[model samples]
Target: MDLVITILVLLLVVALSGAVVRILPIRLPLPLLQIATGALLARPFGLHVEFDPGLFFLLFIPPLLFADGWRIPKRELFLLRGPILALAVGLVFFTIVGVGYFVHWLIPTVPLAVAFALAAVLSPTDAVAVTSITGHATIPPRLMHVLSGEALLNDASGLVALQFAVAAELTGHFSLTTAAGDFALTALGGVAAGVFVSAAFGVVRRRLVRWSSEVDPASQVSLLLLMPFAAYLLAEHFGVSGILAAVAAGMTVNFTDVSKGGYVATRVQSVAVWSMVEFTFNGLIFVLLGMQLPGIVGNAKLDLAQAGGGELWYLAAYVAAITLALIVLRFVWVWLSLRFVLMRALHRGEQRPKVGTRLMWTAALAGVRGAITLAGVLSIPLMKAEDVPFPTRDLMIFLATGVILATLLIGAIGLPLSAKKLKLPGEDPRVKEERMARALSAEAALRGIAEEQKRVEETRDEKAIALASRVAARVVGDYQQRLEAAGEEGDVPEKARAEAGTERIMRLAALRAERRELFDLRRSHRINDETLRALIRELDLAEASLTGLHAE
Candidate 1:
């Protein structure tokens, strides 16, 4: 009962946080608001929540990472692959070495391997937290894509590095050659596992759907929801990177052409369900972080006192120093990368894109550490051996959590200031491409409609011919207008576009009226529940057609 209550309460808080965000005068990101709310629950109200670290990681990280992989623009990821790889792989190693040395020097009590472990957890930026902090439109689209791509790949690398670091700490041994082989095996195996599982599932699901006359949207959605977990567990079972597996599964799903026909409800339900899942999981993680904050600090103080060494104030300075070090390191790396690009551009005799100070700072500040950091830090074992607590476990947790909070705050403050009013140079060709696609599709639709009309004429019944002609004219008028509007010729007048807008407005108004009338009928007991649902669905489909038609 207590466990159930805890879950319900957490969910309630998550839901309420959205409302509170609107009501608050000062703008705070929802993640920050959720965390503050959790802290409130923990500090004054004595709310306590705990779980096995392995289970916590298993529950929240895979689905969130999978969602990121699914939704991030694959084109941008591929185009920016060079820079993204630099940040994701190269910068992770850079931070691991630099921050590892800094932490060890600052606090000699922390072993070198343990310092590297701390740095490893901190290196992976939380692009989700950044997105929440700054809306996508606020950041330059290309830079946002790079940040997202980096976040997607680095989580796996950071966590894998942490595992090796932790092993070294335990056994007092380290080997670059063995680690390199293990890393390759782990990453490659994870990708292979994810591709295989997702591909196999896609094949089986496609066959089953084809064999059956009917499809169950609920079952299909359930299977989709299980996909990330399946990939994660399979890779973990094989002693590989579960994080990469989950990511690979999501990216594979995006590439797979499983939504070709007659699966509209399945796709719709999948979108709605996955949206809810992402929000709930993300909210719960931050809220849990908030709840744990008070305990983490108190325990760290005790650990320090018991160790008979460090002062209480040293903790704050440590967090501040680490956070600053990370920011400086990131800034320097980004600056260096830009310079390297400038040199290459000059060498190739190409126009050098103007490098702005604000852009580099925005890129640096956007590196907000989030849930993955929290989970990895928390998962550090409590005991090194029987009757021996892991050295400075609480202290490390305190430091990592503190750094997460610090980075979030810095990003919240700096990103907007740095990124404001900046324009990226390259034009997105998607607009032109979409217009062309619409024109082509409209032409093809016109041909199909004309062919069907001709078939109707062949029926050779006068009344049928008359009805077919009227219907074809009505449908063909819309497509003809659509083709003109979308065509490259650009000869269509502004008035024609304005009229099309008016028609859409009228159609949307009629859809809303139908919805209201159907609901009124239901309320007056004139329509059965089943009939009401059918009517409402029809209205919803019509409304959907009007809205988000051009959305990417």
Candidate 2:
């Protein structure tokens, strides 16, 4: 109970600090600010909030990963599968080997297995960093797909590798065959668990909605909030990768229409819940990262002191060397993949290649690691195989922390600059405008139709037509105002707040139209039930465009 109260206070503090992050005029990543706040609270006040590694993994990682997987564009994933797989899987392996070897050389006191473990821990890039840094309008869809896919999948790869490394260190043995078998089983189990959980929940949700029309919106949203953790916990108990399970479950739930309510109700509820969760969770992860500095540095202080200036400089040099290696590895892999694989495939008509040096650079820079690394470092056992001390464990933790900070701080500053320097081709403004305008227009049309039906039921044909004309005119007039306003704002990325407001307006219009159409169809027996669903689905896609926009 005390712990719970402390957490509530921390959450409130973090939430308020989020607003301050924007108001400071000084540009810092919101995560960095949150971390700073956490550190300040910890150091002076002595608030030693030690979160369990298992609890942390179970609580934060699943929903974050699942949400990312659900939102990733399916078409783009199909298109960039080759490069994404290479980076997510192949590059992770390469990083583990490269960094592990270097760490063993630099700190001979640390075993090769321990070094490899450290490398594996640092391998996966953070999804929060990617989402926070990249602009959807500025970055190409292909590149976004590759980056997001790599982040999601490499998380599983990196964790698997870390587990193998840990097991090898503990038992003084490593086998490729065992590793391969474990990976296969974990992946298989996660998918099965996710599918089962999502289906069960969908049925339950449907039944609840059917029985009770006044079900609380918050209660419905809470079910989704719990889903990731539930899926993850179940998978873990069954001896599988919970991360993968949560992601698979989210994807499964998204594709199935097993809910009890109308399509609009489900759609609106989902968008609102996911949107809030994504922002808050993403913001909170960075804050945690920033706050953890004091604890990490304290653990490494003795080692830092023992290592003389000469040794300290060598460590710094090695950190710099490995950091550059990680960065270069990404660029080289991307370039080669494009040149030898993607380009040839395009030529052979196997794929429509998304070609550009700028896109390649975006993929490379987006490789900044965050929560996974922190979680991995914190999870490391204090003792190893012989029950002897884990040599250089603190040093390894410090080194990984350095790599994370460097990548995040540098990438955050460098990304926008790099995008500008490379003269990347952003989205076509005209197409964007047309899409927005049509969306707004469709929304208004739906509202006008609803109002017309209401009047038609109350008045004679002549009076009904007159009232409908006025409503239609008002809807069109509002849409035209928005169109002109959007046209005037040249080349600026639309604010999420404005988009959110617009979405509400459009959704109300769409729902109103569906209700009216359903009423008329019921009275006349003009169409079958399935026909109404098909028509409703057409409007649903327009609503989904809002979901797509939020994902971007």
In order, the Cα lDDT scores of the candidates are 0.86, 0.73
Q: Estimate each model's TM-score.
A: 0.93, 0.76
lDDT of 1: 0.86
Which one is best on lDDT?
1
Model 1 C-alpha RMSD vs. true structure (Å) is 2.5
The C-alpha RMSD of each candidate to the native structure, in angstroms, is 2.5, 9.7
lDDT of 2 by residue, 312-384 (tens): 4665676677778788877787787767876677678896655677767767887888776766776677676
Instruction: Quote the positional error of residue 519 for candidate 1 in Å.
Output: 1.6
Off by over 4 Å in 1: 306-311, 425-433, 457-465, 484-493, 549-552
Candidate 2 residue pairs in backbone clash: 34-287, 35-287, 35-290, 35-291
Clashing pairs in 1: none
Per-candidate clashes come to: 0, 4
lDDT of 1 by residue, 390-495 (tens): 7887888889988988988888778877776577545455656777898899899999998998898898989999998999899999988877767554447345
